[model samples]
Target: MTQPASTRRLAVITGASSGIGEAFARAYAKQGVDLCLVARRLDRLEALALELAQQHGIEAFAVQADLSKPDATDRIVTALAEQARSCDILINNAGYSLPQTFLATKAQQQTDFVAVLVTSVVSLTHALLPGMVQRGYGRIINVASMVAFSSGAAGHTLYPAAKSFVVKMTQSLAAEVADKGVLVTAICPGQTESDFAKANGTDQLVAKSNLYKQTAEDVVAIAMSANEAGREVVVPGWPNKLAVAFMKILPDSWTAALIRPQAKKFALPDPTA
Candidate 1:
């Protein structure tokens, strides 16, 4: 891999254990960017850090933390502070999914959804943005889902709900900080092939994923490029863009109805739903 533009430049990525987060780590490393990797799995993180440093010859610092927990952001801040650190780019890629209907979902699991998706993303961004703002140049990327569009599926409500918050929050934050040269971006990807199925309990659809699946690396490429281009929100893939547009054009009732069955297909049994 060619060295990135500046050896001094470093990026922080959440959810770096595997899947989408790992893809982002590899992509950033390819650009010669040093990395601060955060995730729950220490072993997985260490492996990735080693691979990145060895393959791309960039520094890699692994910090293991469950991003869904309240202390996750604090942990990241401490890691950076301890290393005399600050990131040139921040990627809020940590998230969780529950594959059941709202009514059938577990209460604690539901809370986990909010913790990882909404709370973690917000707290991490809040904690990390000050330095970026002061420095007058930085990149902040938030990973969202195309389901965030009004086209939410039946059983996957909380996931989209959290991603919706991410999308709106990124847009608003982008508006606030863009003038300072700090870019805030929300990337919404649709039906990308990922380990999300197994982790989130959607493994049932694994065989059918290829119908609309996207490789994790491909999604990361578009997202990172869009951030550099100052795009606040980027829905990768033409199909994803069309889906977003359809969500806007279709009537709420009709859209909701259409989304219901799809949600059911991937849903975890929710008691309250």
Candidate 2:
């Protein structure tokens, strides 16, 4: 049944089939917000769409596409426009690891990664910002990583660099759109329990439970609150917050040293790197 429309907002979550993105969809639906969930997996997205609509009585639109492609951002905009849907929130959570160093990743693959990590965010914002500005209402959450503070992260260089761009860009956008009631947040959490590592053959990264390992639920909860409260960037846990603080206090070389082995464990074989 279509629930009576209220003042509740609508959100579009990329990578919504599983992991953090899926959690965000569930969380948002709990609030009775309309959803347009996008991901490469059609069956999974449709299942989620049905679940959200049935469980929360909110509209759930599903879009299946590979956001890592160059045309992905345009496709998202076009799809939404076709449905006459203008989302009040955008959660950019579709990212995976390279499993290699910058030099190891093929040029084409690197280019695609760059498109997903940087260009997609930019394009989506460009497409949606005008409406958000006009309405003075919007929330944009760009997901980033814990490695953004390091100099030589050893193996995962390009991924961190890309994430750093997201964090900085989102922070800047938040300041610019503050007065207009458009909120932007960069959710930067480290050592997450997600398939991102497994896809890259770096699943061992999460094996270290002795260290801080945050759940997708926890990370998204922090981000949702930060979005509501207008906090620009949110690193979910106490330990991760401390880690970022320590990185700030330590020398770049020391930070590199601290991150070396883990970086090595996940290093993609980039001979050039």
Candidate 3:
């Protein structure tokens, strides 16, 4: 049965136009949760919001904002206020990898990447967490990656670093709010079938690989379960779980050596070449 509008929870999902973000939005809508879908693609977000609201009998709206911009989170919060809604759930899922070496990319590009991957997560959570604390109910899920546990590779230089920050931040925040009724979790998924690879220009290479890839739906399901159970961190599939375990058990230097060469394949082409 659909929950009454007054009692239905509102979830704010970043990057909701596609991939894992879309998956989370669909899952929450099925449970009768209203949605604020955030992304740069206004048209896609509007279509998704309309479709989900109609199909699920819930309120859903699109908030177009580029998280790389400093003002984006403020705009999102303002939009929610305009709708008279407070976030009961926040999914910090907006992220991308540059696939270029640190020095090869312009400083502005690196900063923008960090803004989306790190700054936005902290900013959005900071803005909405107080209300959740006051209400004594909230769920926050930070979508990290299996690489969070792995050592840094040559390319996609900041990807692992940012994700590691997310994992640690989730753990710390979850500990702080554990007794206050707010659940925080970091879902570190392995290679999943999504536009993530395509955005990073690795889709074809990934497709040709034999490595296991989880569906975005499965990743989100695991994330939702973990958050509800108050788990601090979770890796979706067993293969991913095993990989994380190995990274933890192995020496850092060993893991770094193993990962660097393989990761170079996905790196952007040399600028001077």
Candidate 4:
């Protein structure tokens, strides 16, 4: 792997071993940006880094850490400090969904979900923001989901709620940092052909949906462009955008009634089965 040019900007991406994070890595590398790739899978991260480095002729470093752990942010901070790296862009894309209903899920799994989806995002952003502010330039993309705007599913109760927090937080942070040459955006993509379903053991449920699906590359393209253009929230596909818009006009009771029947189809598989 070639050394990155000192003058090139650096992007730190989480959940970068696969899916949308991997897409972001490819996009950024193509643009000649150096990358710091983080994920729990060290082998995958290293392979991705090597491929991006060789293919794009840019530097790519792999940092393996599980975002759900309390010390995850600290590990990232230390890695950056040791490498004398300061992020020009940060993509908080590490996450997983739980298909089981809140009550059915283990207590520890629920807490870990919160740690990965909420606490880590907040801490990592806070850790990186001071440096961005000092540099007077930064970009952030929080990979939220289309579920943020609607609560249709019965299981995975916290998924939509947690994503809503990300959307709102991104909007609020964008307002504060926009004037300072920093852009913060929430990328709310609908069902995309990523490891999302497989990771959460929802492949069967996802396969039953008639909704349109997108490629991770396509979704990340929309996200990265939206971040660059300073959009607070970027919903990738037209179907997703329209769904969210439609949901906005419907009352909670109406939507809930509509979703009740569908909930059976979307229900998490019994673990014991």
- lDDT values, one for every candidate: 0.85, 0.82, 0.93, 0.90
Against the hidden reference, what TM-scores do the models get?
0.93, 0.92, 0.96, 0.95
Show model 2 residue runs off by greater than 4 Å. 1-8, 268-273
TM-score of 4: 0.95
Per-residue CA lDDT of model 3 for 1-273, tens digit only, reads 954345689999999999999999999999999999999999999999999999998999999999999999999999999888899999999889998788888999999999999999999999999999999999999999999998988778899999999999999999899898899999999988779989888787777777788999999999999999999999999988998998999999999888887887777765854
Q: Summarize candidate 4's per-residue lDDT along 88-188 as a digit string, tens digits.
A: 99999999888887778889999999999999999999999989999999999999998888855767778889999999999999999999999999999
Residue 214, candidate 2: alpha-carbon lDDT: 84
Clashing pairs in 4: none
- By lDDT, is 1 or 4 better? 4
RMSD of each: 3.5, 2.4, 2.5, 2.2
Ranked by TM-score, top first: 3, 4, 1, 2
- Candidate 1 achieves a global lDDT of 0.85
**Residue 165, candidate 1: alpha-carbon lDDT:** 92
Structure candidate 3, residue pairs in collision? none
Instruction: State the weakest 10-residue window (summed lDDT) of model 3.
Output: 2-11
lDDT of 1 by residue, 8-95 (tens): 7788999888888999999999989889999888999999999899999888989989876778889999998877778789999987
Better model by lDDT: candidate 1 vs candidate 2: 1
